[model samples]
Target chain A: MTDNSKTLLELRNIYKSFGPKHVLQGFDLSVAPGQSVVIIGGSGTGKSVSIKCALGLLKPDSGEIYFDGEKQDSAKAVARIRERTGMLFQGGALFDSLKVWENVSFTLTQNQKMSRKDARDAAIETLKKVRLGASVADQRPAELSGGMQKRVALARAIISKPDLIFFDEPTTGLDPITADAVNDLIREQVQALGAAAVTITHDMASVRKIADDVAMLYDGKIIWRGPVDRLDDSGNEYIDQFVHGRADGPIQPSM
Target chain B: MIFNPFAAIGRASMAAFSEIGRLAIFTGRVLLACLTPPIYLREFFSQCMKVGFFSLPVVGMTAVFIGASLALNIYVGTQFGAEQIVPTISVIGITRELGPVLAALMLAGRVSAGVAAEIGAMKVTEQIDALHTLSAKPERYLYAPRVLAATLTMPILVLIADIVGLMGAWMICVAALDFSGPTFLRNVWQENIYENVSVGLIKAAVFGMIIAIMGCYQGSNSKGGAGGVGRAATLAVVGAAVLILASNYVMTSMFADT
Candidate 1:
């Protein structure tokens, strides 16, 4: 095995801006194989921007994003990199026109060119992995509860058996207990598949359950990052303020 | 005491012109991207079914009724000439101009509005972003299929429109206008040409592309939430209808002698 292949995805000195407002500035992060790296930040603090840049949805003004140690600057490389990753969006984002199984099997049917029956079988298996009943597969996303929709989104994300997965605000809108369940499910899936994960959320509860390593984003840079066990005693005031959910801290709101 | 309606109309007119200019440039870029391909055929077929097949009933009904009315009007005008001229003008006008144009406008109202609303909601819900994250190109997965389907199906719809319209005109001429069957049939066939049918089909195809692309573009770029999706749908239908009418004039003139 190659030395860098142990690290599934890496971002170095990434920068992105919209108009005059810079979103990501010299951000550096790496996900070791099978590691769950959770990024915690306030809304609009470049957490989603970092994920978008890695997926090539938003172009970075400067810096390198590497998938399996290969830079993702060229179109060919970007396509190659993206094919190995999957994402669960905040809203579940399932196609309303599609049945739940169709949504889960979308990538396999569309990108991988799998046959419909084969895709459906894979979708059912993934649903089982996410603890969704097989009977729920034929129903549309509109028929599902909020928590059920999230589970279906999880099924979709893992259906491809992606080497890396990005979870964007996975627990944002769910009730606390449901959120905790989702967090546990995320943890279980990462471990079961031995896939690296980068989950972005503001919820400290999610971070506690899902993160092997936690990174705190502020002002376009990662202000603090370490093993999850060290988050409480990171000795960084910013991390402390954020983890504790204090409004008044070293970090100030803009006027 | 009264608002200056003319000024509001003038401002709206200017905004519409500017939007047209901007969309033209955007369309050129999309077309350039279209040439480079890893064509997503299933997505394209799905969208084609959505935009074209699903839109048939509305377009067909509009054309048939319009044709019936046109025949009646032509018969009334034909007091200046032989009654046989009603069939000739009804077939000529409807086939060469009205059928394609009206079908397109109807599609703009029905299918384009639906496309805009659907995609706009998708955008707001981050479904498009989800597609991107799944390693699928949104343009290919979403827009290309829609554009291709509309382009392919419009000609067929317009042909159906022409036939159905002629039938409507025939029914009106025989029953309402008291024109004889043999006379109506002869005049209608005599006035129709391969060029007329081809031109109308061509116009329908172009209008389909315009409707689908405009809807997809507006929806894909929608901002905010419910308000944004509403605006996108409204704009898509209104803009597509206007473009269909404006382009019909231009296309009709181009194929005038044909």
Candidate 2:
């Protein structure tokens, strides 16, 4: 697992289960520094669970998570990893109680103890990177449109210029055009920051747009993974069926 | 059929025990977090406003009404000869038992439900998870502020309730029951003031801790969707109310001899 010096994050033989349902079983994946890895999977395929496990939000029953070449097991280790990582939850998960700017600069002000004025300025600057105007900074998340909220969340995720970022369905509720714009923005920001990114998404277009590498998760394991160019011709039936969005292939719709 | 019945009973008992264990552990964690550093002063003040200041009106109104009703009941129950004891009895009852218990019950309905709904919504929307990713401990940032505010504020609320309740009783007795206001006040002040008020305040603090803990425990464990949040709120209110009453009985027993 530590063979590659460039590997920024690795999940080795991870397993997670809730009650009687096993969500992840022996899941394995690795991401290199400055690379964007998009995990593609069908519904209920443990994509979110895997990301949560990696982030220490959910503890895996077995296996280890390596972040920046160090094991993340203890609470101290997890906190250190989280300090350098940013996450974009599927629903934006903006603190409804805080203004948009406050939400964006929450880590900066609360954890880093930055002055409010400085944090607000930094937040506005980050918002601009996501193509949001300064006018929206003082507004609440509910006041923004779905796309605008997504942009705010994106801004919040990258405001600290984290060493690693995780995006959970960044384009789930957006229209195709807005989704494409978000994908483009995410790609541009990740490239500019040169940070490793892990995006879990079911949107094929997003996978195509933001992924340097694509991994398919099915039945609690990564069945196929390679460069984005290899996704269409992965030669794995599960990956082929998923990428093509076909029902007749080896994967039957779970009823 | 026999085995099925036995298994069902065993499973239900185990679930109940597990739930109690979880709540106890959650309460311990909240206490530990309170002792730790990185206290969120802003959140604590906001919670104080929500749990204490904003609840003054409802707690006050309930206290006044209960006080008046208790006075009327005592006047009716007493013979003409024993009617002079009304003021002392009303004051003793309000401060020693009725004031703290009723105020806590009202807050359990109001504040506990609100905390559960707010935190449950946060859980459902992944804000709790978002906080974790931001390297913020939910127990420190969320639970400690709430528990500390509630525990510290409940005594003040009970103190207010006691005064309002006694005033209501005095007003009712003097105006309608042919009693003098000065005489009634004198009787209320002369009868075990320190013992009654102190016991009530102590109970208020303990009740406040229970309310906050139950609300947060149910809310933080909430799952599913809107339905789950609703259930959490309902359970929080019910749990807090029940715990307040049950603990009140235990506390009263302990304070009875004193």
Candidate 3:
């Protein structure tokens, strides 16, 4: 059990909807300090919304969010949470118009005191931590390959050494080998930062590689959660069907 | 089934009203960001260069050709004793009407389309969401600089266009119309006061704001994928043009005596 006092981030009974489509209902998640929690769910299951609500990127229709054990109900509290966190988007989302280093050092550039040269140098240093060479730092995001872009995004996310990091399908489009490498990099970097991580992905390999604990989202709420070691025997029919990749099960495909 | 025409009309009206309300709120937030901290000086200067400097050639070309054409048309139209007032009418028409309108229309096509496409792409790819998580307000980092730049730069661009346009009239008057260069220059200066210039510049500033707002609004609100971005660009240009013409009429009415 996670000590409530020690929770770095927590979402309690979040509900969000767009028009008539109810995306999240009674969704809850919590990440302890230095823990890696991977959320598993089918597409459109609001796995992403869970983390987005926690980050305050998407306001929940109803919920309470706490960061660093402080309730983020006020605008100032939400701003503080945003300032202390980093996110790696599914598409990498590097600014295509900016050079690689500029993309990596984006937050620092907003500081007004960091010279462009100094920011670029810091970006290059962070890139090396993700096993990228300085040469790639000058190239545009469009000029890089998919795997390289993911690494660059990882570098960007960790460049600030944030208190928490959120990854949205961090390995979605990569090759199996590249995905494994990124998963390793994510685990190593999160440990190095001593930061809690909440990742959203349905990729089972990713879950096994990166999650200290696993949470399953279904029908707009968390239905199952357990340590990674217990994932195979979670015994929840939904999770069992999901883990075994079975078509014949209680979980039905929607039209 | 059953198609109810009045119900459909009501729905359409409601949608349009909703869209207008959203745009108003969006513009309000951007304006507030303009006065707040973290103004993004580099982006402001960069947008100024883009909106004012880079647009010089297009604006210049349009003004010059229109000025020359107006001089010829007025010279031909007033073949009787009214020929002497050709320079005055040409100067008034260009500065008070054609110069600002043409320049803004050109910008509606160029700047609006570009801004819409770029911001639309960013939105679809989640860069805007990334900005949100990064603690960077998109209104501050993206919208306001462009808005402020366009607002400030349009008048400057129009001022240059006014000069180029007058020069075009002067060239035609001296070379083709047999008017004395000295008299033509003197007439243009004495007849066209600073009021004519200020009214047109004021119109240009408002038109510039419309272009930026339409572009950024359509763009940041865009979704889906490439098709969505394409639609945003199209809507931005169309919206800017419509608003430009509509606002131009309103302002002209407000300053009817001038």
Best by TM-score: 2
State the weakest 10-residue window (summed lDDT) of model 2 chain B.
Answer: B79-88
Q: Write the per-residue lDDT of candidate 1 for residues B1-258, one digit (tens) a residue.
A: 799999999999999899778888767656554567877776777877877788888878988899899988877666675466777787788888898888888888887888889899999998998887777776777777777788789999999999999889989878876778888788877865577788988998899889888888889878899999999999999888888888888987888778
Best by lDDT: 2
- Lowest summed lDDT over 10 consecutive residues: which window, candidate 1 chain A? A1-10
Regions of model 3 farther than 4 Å from truth: A1-5, B1-6
- Write one digit per residue (lDDT tens) for candidate 3, span A1-255: 233358888889999999999999998888888888999988888888788788777888998989987998888898899888999999999988789999899989984358999999999999999999999988999999999999999998998889889999999999999999999999999999888888999799999998989999989999999999999988899999988888788777654
**Cα lDDT tens digits for candidate 2, B1-258:** 346988899999999999999998999999999878888999999999999999999989999998999999998888865445888788889998999999999999998998999999999999999999998889998999999999999999999999999888988887888788788888888988989999999999999999999889999999999999999999999999999999999999999977
The pairs that clash in candidate 2 are: none
lDDT of 1 by residue, A95-188 (tens): 8888999999999998888999999999999999988989999999999999999999999988878888899999888999999989999989
For DockQ, candidate 2 versus 3, the one ahead is 2
Interface RMSD after interface superposition, each candidate: 1.2, 0.5, 1.0
Evaluate model 1: give its TM-score: 0.90
Name the docking class for model 3.
Answer: medium
**lDDT of the candidates, in the order given:** 0.86, 0.92, 0.90
DockQ of each: 0.69, 0.88, 0.77
Two-way lDDT contest, 1 vs 2, winner: 2
Question: What is the number of backbone collisions in each predicted candidate, taken in the order shown?
Answer: 1, 0, 0
Please identify model 2 stretches exceeding 4 Å from their true place: A1-5, B3-6, B81-83
Clashing pairs in 1: B44-B145
In model 3, the Cα lDDT at residue B249 comes to: 96
